[model samples]
Target: MTAILTFFTTLACIVTLLPFSRHPHWAIRGMDFPRLQFAIFIAVLLIANFVFLNKQSQFTWVVISITALCLAWQLWWILPYTRLWPHEVKETKESSPDKQISIMTANVLTPNRKVDKLIQLVQIHKPDVLVTLESDQWWEDQLKVVEVDMPHSIKCPLDNLYGMHVFSRLPLSNQEIAYLVEKEVPSIHTTLTLDSGDKVRMHFMHPAPPSPTENPQSAERDAELIIVAKSVAKSNQPIIVTGDLNDVAWSATTRLFRKISGLLDPRVGRGMLNTFHADFPFLRWPLDHLFHSQHFTLNSIKRLPPIGSDHFALLTKLTLSPTVGADQTGLESNTSDHNWAKEITENQSISVNDVPQVDNSK
Candidate 1:
C-alpha cells in the first residue's frame, strides 16, 4: 500500500513540474489541471506522512525528505510575486481632450441561464465598453435588446464557445475579427473613438483553454498571445487588451506578455482578483484581465458580482494621455495613473509577416 501511494505521489509531483520545465508545447491548454494535481498530491502526501509518524513507521525519514522537497518547490512557485513588478514611465504629452472610459469584460459561460443577472449588472454599471466572451447565438439574442442603448456593437455569434461580442457607447473604427490561434476562435479588434474624439485601439480575446478536450497543449495559445503582445508593442496608439485569458495573473506567460507588449496590469500592489470558478470562490484564480499601454492611466478597477456564470466580470476605468517628446517617448508609463496614453506614430510600419499563421484545419 505504501509503495503504491509513494509511486503515485511521485508521479503527480513530476507531472506538476513538467509544465515549468522547457517543454516543446508548454502553453497549449489549461495549466490549472497540473497545478491542481500537484496540490492534491501534496495534500495526500501530508496526510500519509501524518499517519506514518503517528504509527512510528520505519520509512518516516524518506517521507519527510520528499515532503520537504515538494514544499520547497511550492515555495518557488510563489516567489515571483515578491519581486518588483515592471512599471511604465509617465509621459508628458497631455491628452488632447481627456475623457474617462469604463470597460467591463465578462465570460458569460455559454450554458448559463442568468441573462437577467448579466443585464442587471450591465444596467447598473453602464460601462462605456462591454466585452463578453464564450458567447453564442443564444447569448447574443438575449443581449440584442441592450444594443439599443449601446448603439455600436461587433457581434460574432458562434456555437464553438470561442464566440465573442463587444458593445460600446463610443464609435468603432477599423473593426475586424482576427483569428490568431484557430479559425473557429476569433478575437475582436478595433479602435474605439471616445466622446472626446480621441481614438484608442482595443483588442478583446478569449483563446481556447488548454485541456484534454481542447488542444491538449498550451504552445499555440502562448504563441498567439505573444503575437498580440508584439503587435501592441509596435502600435503608436493607446491600446487596451481585455478578456478571460484562461491563465492566471502571476503565471510566467502573463509576465512575458506584459514585457513583450509593454502594457501594464492594474492588479500589481492590488490583490489577485480571481474571476473564475465563481461558484466556489476559494478554488478561483484571476483569469479575466485588463492590460493597457503606457499612454493610459487607471481610474478604477474592480471585480463585479456573479452573473450566473463560472467567471466574474472585471470593470476598469481609464484616461488617456499623449507621449512627451521623442526622447521621452517609448518610456513605459506607470501602472497607477488614471490618464495614460502611449504614442504610436501612424507612419511606423509593422509587417504582419512575423505573426504566426493559424491553420484553419484541425
Candidate 2:
C-alpha cells in the first residue's frame, strides 16, 4: 500500500510540474487543466501518508517534501481566482436596460439534442445575445425558435465538432466566419449595436482542445488566441470575447491572452463557476467563459442549470460604461509575455494550405 501511494504521489508531482516546460504536447499541456482536483488529491495524500506511514524514514520525508511542493505550485496558480485575491473586474455601480448587454454562452455538446432545455432557459433568461458551441446542423435547426426574436445572427453550422452559431436581438454588422488555425474549425467575429446605440466588437470562438484525440498539441489553440489577442490589442473599440476556450482561467496561455488583449474576466475573485462536464460532479471545471474589455462593468453573472449537455451555460450582464475603467485595472502584458506570445504564434502560424490537418475520421 505504501509503495502504491508513493507512486501516486510522484506521478501527481510530475503532472503538476510538467506545465512549466512550455511544451504543447497533449499530455504536457493537459496538466494545466486539473490543478484544483490535484490540489485536493495532494491534501488527501498528505493526510494518508501521516496516518498510514508508521516510520519517519528518509523515503517518507522525501515523499512529504514532493507533495508539499506540488501543493504549493497548484495553489499558486489557483489562488488568484479565489476570494482571497482582489477582483480584476469591478461590479457595475448602476445598470440600465439601454446601457446593459446580456449574453448567454453554451456548449450544447452537439450530440446531446436537449434543445427544449436550452430553449426554456433562453425563455427565462431572455439574454440580448446567445452563443452556442459544438453546434451542428441539428443544433442549428433546434435553435431556430430563438431566431424569431433574435433576428440577427451568424451561423456556421458544420458536422465537425467545431461548429458555432450566434443569435442576437441587437443589430449585427461586419459579420465574418474565420477558420483561423484549422480549416474545419470556424470562429465568429462581428460588431453588435446595443439599444443605446453603442457598438461592441465581439469574437466568439471554440478552439479545439489539447487532447490525444484532437489536435494533440496546444500550439494551434494558443496561436489562434494570440492572433485574436493581437487584433484586440490594436482595436480601440469595446470588445467582448466569449466561448468554450478549452483552456482554463488560470493557465499561463490564458493569462498572456488576457494581458495582450486587456480583457478582464468576471470570474476572478468571484468564483470558479465550473461549467464543463455537467454530468459529472467530481470532474468538472470552468471551460465556458465570458471576457470583456474595460469599457464594461459586470452587472451579474450566472451559471445556468444543466441542459443535458457536457457544459452548463454562462449568462453575464454588463453595462457599457467607460467611466468604470478608472476604478478598474486589467493585467498588463510584460516583455516575457510578449516574447512567449510571439514564440507560440510563430510556431503555429502555418498557412491554411500548409497546415497539417488532423484526421477527423475515427
Candidate 3:
C-alpha cells in the first residue's frame, strides 16, 4: 500500500512539473488545465501518508515532501485567481448604462440543439454584446429572434464547429471576420461604439484545443492568441477579447497573452468561474474567458446557469473609464515577456487569411 501511494505521489509531482517546459504536446500542455485538481489530490495524498503510513522511513519522508512541494507549486499559479489575492481588474463602485457594456459569451456545443435556453438568457440579461462560439447554421437561425432588437451583427456560420457569430445592440464599426491561425476557425474583430460615443475594439475567438482527436499540440492555439495580442498592442483603443479560449486561465500561454496585450482578467481575485464540462462538476476548468484592457472596471462577473452546452456562458459587465488603466495593477509587460511573445508568434507555422475588409458605411 505504501509503495502504491508513493508511486501515485511521484506521478502527481511529474504531471505538475511537465507544464513548466515549453513543449506543446497535448499531454504536457494538458497539465495546465487541472492545477486545482492536482492540488486537491496532493492534499489527499499528504493526509493519507500521515494516517496510513505506520513507518516513517526515508521513502515516506521523500514522498511527503514531494507532495507538499507539488501542492505549493499548484497553489502558486492558482492563488491569484482566488479572493485571497488582489484583483487584476479593479471593481467599479458604480456604473452608468451609457459608460458600461455587458458582454455574454456562450460556447453552445454544436450538437446541443437547445437554443431556446440561450435565447431566454439573452432576453433576461439583454447584454450589449452576445458572442456565441461553435454556432453553426442551425444556431444562427435559432438566434434570429435577437435581430429585432440587436440590429448590428456579424454571422459566420460554418459546419466545422468553429463557427462564431456576434450580435450587438451597440453600433459595431469595421466589423470583419478573421481567420487568425486556421482557415476553418473564424474570429470576430470589430469596434463597438458605446452609448457615450467611445469606441472599444472587441475580438472574439474560439481557438481549437490540444486534444487527442483534435490538434495534438498547443502551438496553433498559442500562436493565434499571440497574433491577436500583438495586433491589439499596436492600438491604444480599449479592447475586450472573449470566447472559449480552449485554454485555462492559469496556463503560462494565457498569462503571456494577458501580459503582452495588457488585458485584465476579472476572474482574478474573484473566482474560477469554470465554464467547461457542464455535465461533470468534478472535471471542469475556466475555458471560457472575457479579458479586457485596464481601461474597464468590472461591474459584475459570473458564470450563468448551464444552457445544455458543455460550456457554461460567462456574463461580464464592465464600466469603461479612460483613466482607470493607470490605477490598475499587474497589466504591464516587461521586456522579457515581449521577447517571448515575438518568439512564440514567429515560431508558429499556421497560415492566417488576409484581414477581411470591413465596410463602415452602414
TM per candidate: 0.74, 0.93, 0.95
The residue-by-residue lDDT of candidate 3 on 251-318, one tens digit each, is 99999998887778999999899998899999999999999877899899999988999999999999
- Top TM-score hit: 3
Cα shift from native, residue 170, model 1 (Å): 1.4
The predicted structure with the larger TM-score, 1 or 3, is: 3
Model 1 agreement with the true structure over 168-249: per-residue lDDT tens digits: 8888877888776577978888888878877788888887766667766665556666668767766777778899887777
Pick the winner on TM-score between candidates 2 and 3: 3
lDDT of 2 by residue, 177-210 (tens): 8888888988888888989988888989889999
Per-model C-alpha lDDT, please?
A: 0.69, 0.86, 0.87
How many Å off is the CA of 255 in candidate 3? Answer: 0.5
* TM-score winner between candidates 1 and 2: 2
Q: Give the TM-score of candidate 2.
A: 0.93
